[model samples]
Target: MSARDWQKSSFSGEGNACLYVSAPDNATIRLRESDEPDTILTTNPTALNALIRNAKAGRLDHLSKG
Candidate 1:
């Protein structure tokens, strides 16, 4: 799949600084920052699921460090 079709997280705003994620395919998930498409990160479904779960559980709220 082409990166052009990937969707940016709802948290993304007007600025070009944002992260984008593509739907899972072949057990792998794709991630890249809008400002740096050349640097993509791939992760396994299990790990991705865990991260999502943690975020939902508020365990990852530290990401918004004040």
Candidate 2:
């Protein structure tokens, strides 16, 4: 794929510790952290939406605990 226009949330407020996202194609979504640009995480729209929904519902909060 060619270079993508990655976007970060405005709430991130200019820092190298935010998450960046890009939709290089209709079937794929890409994510990466500013502090680790070389490492990317890929997912589809459906899976991404599921994750977001679960997160907002607090269903994934247990994963963050030790």
Best by TM-score: 2
In candidate 2, what are the lDDT values of residues 1-66, reduced to their tens digit? 334589885667676778888898898999888888889999999999999999999999999999
Candidate 2 segments whose C-alpha is farther than 4 A from its true place: 1-4
Per residue, candidate 1 scores C-alpha lDDT tens digits across 1-66 of 586769989999978889898866768788999888888899988999899899999998998999
Number of backbone clashes in candidate 2: 0
List per-prediction Cα lDDT, in the order shown. Answer: 0.86, 0.86
Quote model 2's TM-score.
Answer: 0.86
Scored against the true structure, residue 32 in model 2 reaches a CA lDDT of 85
TM-score between model 1 and native: 0.67
lDDT against true structure, model 1: 0.86
